[model samples]
Target: MKNRNQSKKPKFIVISEQIISKIISGELLPGEKVPSENELIHNFQVSNTTARKSLQEIESRGYAQRIKGKGTFVLNKTEDHHLVRTLGSIDATRRGFDEGLKVEGFKPKTIVLEKTVLDHGVSAEISGKSYIIEGPVLKVHQLRYADEMLLKDETKYISLKLCPKINMLSTDLSYFKVYEDKYQLKISDIKQNLSAIILPPDDPTNNFEYESALPVFVLDSVVLSRKDAVLELEKSLYRGDKYKFAIIAHPEYNGN
Candidate 1:
C-alpha cells in the first residue's frame, strides 16, 4: 500500500513541469531566455541546487538548452526541417525506414560504425516482458541519415539463432528486408518505447558533433517473429529537431 497523503513528486520535478507547461502554452518561445538559477531561486523560494536541478530537468527533456556564459534558452523548433512520421495502429505492420523516407522524397542511408559477435547472451525487458537472447548475438552500431542530414544513431542486438551469419550481410542494406527476404523469417510485431533524453557531452558512443548537449528521442524497440520469438533488440537515438512522431487516437466508449 502507498501513502495517500504524501507528495509523490519532488520539488525540482514540480518546478520543471510548471516551466514545461509554460513552454507548451506558448508563454515561452523558442530562443527566448529561460529563468536563471538565481531567478528560479528567488521566484520559487528554493535553494540554488534545487533551482539548478529544475533547469537541468527541463533541458534533459529537450525543452531548453544552455549556453556557456549566457543563460539557458528554449530550443529552436523548425517546422520546415521536422519530418512528420505517422504511427499507425499497433497491430498494423511497421514500415521500413528506407521505404518511409523514400515516400517523402528523401534518400535514406545507413552507415555501419562497428559490428561484433558477442560470446554471451543479452537480456532485455520490453513492454513488461523479459527476454534473454542466446549466445553468439550480433551487435551493430550504425548511423542513419536522410539525404545529407543525420537523423538517427542506432545500436542493434540480433539473435544469431534466428539470423545466423547475419554479420556477413551488407551493412548498408535494411535489416528488416533481410529478415523477411534472406532469412525467411516472418516478423510478427514490434514493441517500442520512446522518451526524450539528452546525450551526454562526453559519451563515447555519441557520434554527433555539437557544442552543447544534444536533445534526442531514445527509442527502445523489440522485434518479434511468429509465435513471439524475439529476433532483435534495438536502442535508437533520433534527432529531436529533425523528426516528429504522429499517432492517431480513438476515444474509448464507456456505456452510459
Candidate 2:
C-alpha cells in the first residue's frame, strides 16, 4: 500500500488515500474487487452517498471504476509517461481526439537534433547495449492542427533498429499505432523531463512573432516496456501555446 501518513483532511480524501495505500500495498490488484457500497459505509462510518463519492473520486483520480453490475473494480492505471506520450488508445471521442488530425505537414527524414551521443548512464534490459538504441535517434517532424490554428509541431525520435520502417515512412501515420499494430510492440511505461526553452526547430513562428510568445516546452523521455527494455529515447519541442498537459494519479496495476 502507498505509505501516506494520516492527515486530517476531508473524509473522501482520507478514504481515497487509503484506497491508494491498499493498491500500493498490493492488497488490491488490478480487477480486484473493492468493498461494496454497504461494506464501505459500515467500515468507514460514512453515508452511502459519501461512499459513492469516494469511489467517484477514485475513478476521477485514475484509480478505480464502477461497472454496471460488477461493483467497483481496480483499474490498471499507467505510470505517467511522456515525450509524445501515446495518449494510448484513449477514449478519443471523449477527449476530442475524434476531432481529427489537420495534417499541415508530414515528413519523415533524418534530423540530427542531438549532435553527439553521450552515455545517458542507462542500459537497455532487452539488448543490454551500452548506447541509446544502436544508432542516431531519427527525429520525425510533424505539424498538426485540429482546426485552422496551429496545433503542435512534434519532433519524435525512433531507434533505427526498433523502427527501420520509419526511414521509409512516406506519409504521416500514427507513430504509436504503427509501433503496436505493425511492429507488435506495446509502450508499457514512459519517463519524461519537461522544461521551458526558447523554441528552436519545433515552432513555426518566425522571428517577428517571437515577441508575443513565451518559451517553448521541451519534453525528453525514454519509453520502456514492462520488462525494463528501453524502447526509445525521444526529445521533442512543443509549441507552448498549442500544447497543454494534464496528469492525474490513480490506483493501478503495473504489469507484475
Candidate 3:
C-alpha cells in the first residue's frame, strides 16, 4: 500500500493554477470577475474550505483583489507583466519604439527634424570609439508619432564609416534594416539602460508635447557590430502611459 503520508496534490492548488493559466493566456483580462469561492467549490466539487483557501492564495499572490462584498476581480496586468529587460529577447509586441505599436491600433511615424555632421572628435565621444569612424559621422534628432500624437523623441549617433551614404537614407526608415539589408552588417549585441523622469514644465529641451508633470521612460542603448565595433548610440524617450514591458525569468534552471 502507498504511504498515507506521501505527498498528494492539493485540490485548491490545481484549481488556482487553472484560473491563473487563463489570466496569463489573455482569456481572462484585467478587471474581469474571477470565479468566486462558492463557484469554485460547486464547479470543482471541492470542499468550501479548499475553495476559500484558493481564493485567498490568489489574492495574496497579487493576481486578484477581493473586495468585502464586490467579490474577487483580476488585478491590472501591468503589475504581473513588468519585465527586467536585461539581456534577452524582449516581447516584440510590447516594444515602444517600433512598428509593433500597430498591434495597439497606433500608426508609427518617425520624423527626422535635424541632422548635424559633428566634428570627428565629437563623433568619437558619442560612439565610444577612436576617430577611425568611416564615411561621415552625424547626429540625427527625430520625433516619433503614434496616431499623430507626439509619443517619442530620439537622438541617434550613427557611424557611416562602414557603410557610406547612410546619411542619405529616409528618416522614417528603421536603421536596423539599413544596417542588415544595405550594409549587410551582422549585429553582435546591444546594451541598454532605462530610467524614469518627470519633465519640468519650464524645460525647453523637452521637445515632446505632453504635460510636464507626467513621467516618461528613457532608454539609452548602444548597438554593436559583429567585430564588437560600436555602430550606433541611441537615446530615446517614451511616453510611460503608452507602453508596457514584459520579461520571463527562470529561478531554478541554470544554463551552462
Residue-wise lDDT of candidate 2 within 1-256, one digit each (tens)? 2334444567887887788789667566544557777888999999998888888888787767676675776664435211122322232211222122211111223222223222223332222334255454455555544334433445555665566656566434555566666777777765666667775443564321344555567666666554665656655555565554544356798999
Tens-digit per-residue lDDT, 1-256, candidate 3 = 3334332657777778788888778666555568988899889998999999888887777777776675776765564332222333322211334433332224567777898776562323323434234436778899988668777788887886765777787766667767887899887766566678988756787777666566778877777787877777777787676654344455886776
Model 3 clashing residue pairs (backbone): 134-161
- Model 1, position 158, has a per-residue lDDT of 91
List runs of model 1 lying over 4 Å from the truth. Answer: 1-79, 87-95, 248-256
Best by lDDT: 1
Local error of candidate 2 at 76, Å?
Answer: 27
Pairs that collide in candidate 1 are none
User: Every model's Cα RMSD, please?
Assistant: 17.4, 12.6, 11.7
Give the least accurate 10-residue stretch of model 3, judged by summed lDDT.
85-94
Model 3 stretches astray by more than 4 angstroms? 1-98, 121-135, 248-256
Candidate structures ordered by lDDT, highest first:
1, 3, 2
lDDT (0 to 1) per candidate: 0.77, 0.53, 0.66
For model 2, what is the C-alpha lDDT against the true structure? Answer: 0.53
TM-score, candidate number 3: 0.58
- In candidate 1 the C-alpha lDDT for residue 143 amounts to 87
Q: How many backbone clashes does candidate 1 have?
A: 0
